[model samples]
Target: MLSENKLWYQNSRMEETKALLLQARQEGFRSIRLNLFPAAVAEGGVDAIDAWYQSLRVLVTYGNSVGLHMIIDLHESNRCGVDASECRRLTTDFWSRTAGMFSDTRFDVSYELLNEPKGEMVSQWGALYPQLIKLVRSKDRHHSIIVGGKGYSTIWDLPPADPDQERIIYTFHYYNPMSFTHQGADWLKAHPSLAERRNIGWGSYADRTRLAIDFRSVDGWRSRNDAPLFLGEFGVFKRAPAEDRVVWLSSVARMSEERGITWCLFDYEGGFGVEGLLPAIQKGARRQP
Candidate 1:
């Protein structure tokens, strides 16, 4: 989304991205998961898609060389009514095109079919997932795929894995009790009541307790399904108190590692990121091989 200037995909940003990747590697991070807003499958269609693919390939190739696994997360999907045939067609077609195109991507590359699916998309995931999985597996079998359930990939109501599907990883995003995370945002203050809260910070015993209980559900689901868990995204808003954001992220990182889950924070250059956050997480990590 930041690539919306007159230049679009500016070279300075690309260099900054590389620097961030190298920084993450220097910390204890093993992989990078990037959100994609559009694909060649939309708007300009094939030619557009091919151009996007080639541009991303350059980054992927460099990431592979540097030992950072890349997760290409399709963060947007057709979120229309279940009865709307157009929605399903749009999503299915996008994945079909995507999976076929990246069938031979390097081992370090993976795919996340959709991002934080909500509305009809989440409600009908069972019906939608199999179709997309079939299409992806039909075209590409080399890399792993990450799948998420309803409620914006929260622990609640996560769909279980079908039998014999071993390669798919389960994912969730955590910003639980958004009160503390998104505090003071004017956008969230559109309503009178929500605007009253001020300077909310993380680190209460109640906060820790709630987070543990929520994550325990994910732990249970993973045990039952035997699917690897990926904490694909988690972070407080940039507006949150720096101390609270750092500590909250560190706590979450520690919790994920204790359960053998892999995680990637919300962003590097974004608001949620603090200069010392990655290093802090790394310091506490088990450094699991």
Candidate 2:
């Protein structure tokens, strides 16, 4: 599960976080990906980041106590693509200072370098990650590093994983047939046609076949490259037909597990909140032996 709550450093946050973690554990979730903002962390300077670090330590420690693994995700990328030199500096700077937090080996946490590389950085990420890997390895050799290709890391856009890289997991986001998944997203409202589109039905034979074909492609990539795959994000917007959302979510989740891909839902408590679809998610999680 992915928690995008921005109140991690705010008052009463721990109580809320504690409740969330407990609920997740009871619900059969094995991990929680904490979506963090790099710009916010950087803007806060040392004091701000120090406080955030303390909160993170609390979450990681408490989460692991309950058998839940944690994934620290840097959830922003807009500022990085402004310029080549600026991108390198900012990307390296963030990891340089933050990677040490994951060095303690005792914590069950992994580092996701960035959310979704776009624009020039998409092409540049392939080159940039090696440096980031080297930087993180310098500080922490115990945790896994998550990386994904550009174009929002969609399955079709995913690049071949490198067999030479150790301790790295290749990731991809899925919201295929966007018309069905993002029907009423506020951000997409600027495109009136898409924004107004609703009630898009799923579960047709073509729909299931398309998903199978796409995941099969990824399975092939994983085999040929000897890489681990993670379905970093996938969900239907809340505004969609509730029944359709359940079906879509269940289908994706089931297919992912069937093919041995580790998956994470898009969010918790946000637009794609999993609260309403827990049944579907749990049902899909039943891995076939």
Candidate 3:
């Protein structure tokens, strides 16, 4: 999957998005994940949201025409989690309308209920997700529903596979040893020192062993429940040592494939993007499905 981020949602960038979809398809990406903010798209009311999805239909249609599957990710975070009753209600309502709107489309689409549920919300994601899943299933049972655990979808916190839901796929984001992957990342206020950190190599035997152990555990979980798994996000920041970043990405991606897991790179264009799509991707860091 190629994460185009907000570029695909901006009304002014529709033509640009079309070109991107075509580019991704040509480069062998089978799908694209659209990070969507429903509330931001239609703030006035439900009617506004309905209109917004009508616009989305055009994008989805174009994406499918190019042989790219679509992952409709609800990229909201503030309004989810525990005790946010009003927020929860509004989120639920969005999915209801969203599910209803896309249920009949012939194109391949997957609904990611929410992106990176954090803090208190992560603590109760197991409980919250099933409710949303039930709501979504009521409207659209044909398409797969993707979900993840708390701690921002960390593998260690992955929720147990649900035996009751066959069409559901569990997801996790891997940015382990964040000191390496997130080095020089300014947005991490809690770790301001990372801004100056660089050249953090990550290919020690211990590091490789730890990665294998983590992925194998997830593979075991999938086997136990007969469920599918998706490594929805994984990438190294641009400032990391170039060779080390490539090794890490290649290792993680290849490991996911060895375990029969599908993955989406963290981004196509961003601070953690696969710039030029040549060095890392062509060097065996990425494999097309």
Residues 30-140, model 3: lDDT tens digits = 888887777655666777666667768898889988898999888776556444565477669878988887888596899998888875676667778899999999999
For residues 222-245, write the lDDT of model 2, one tens digit per residue.
667777889999988888888788
Q: Rate the local accuracy (lDDT) of all candidates.
A: 0.70, 0.79, 0.79
**Per-residue accuracy of model 1 over 174-271 as CA lDDT, tens digit each:** 88877877666566644444345577887788888888888888778977886788888787777777777777887788789888888888876565
Give me the overall lDDT of model 3.
Answer: 0.79
Clashes of 3: 1
RMSD of each: 3.7, 2.3, 2.9
Which of candidates 1 and 3 is the stronger one according to TM-score?
3
Model 1 lowest lDDT segment of ten: 1-10
Give the winner by lDDT: 1 or 2: 2
Give the count of colliding residue pairs in each prediction.
1, 0, 1
Q: In candidate 2, residue 225 scores what lDDT?
A: 78
Residue pairs with colliding backbones in model 3 are 81-121
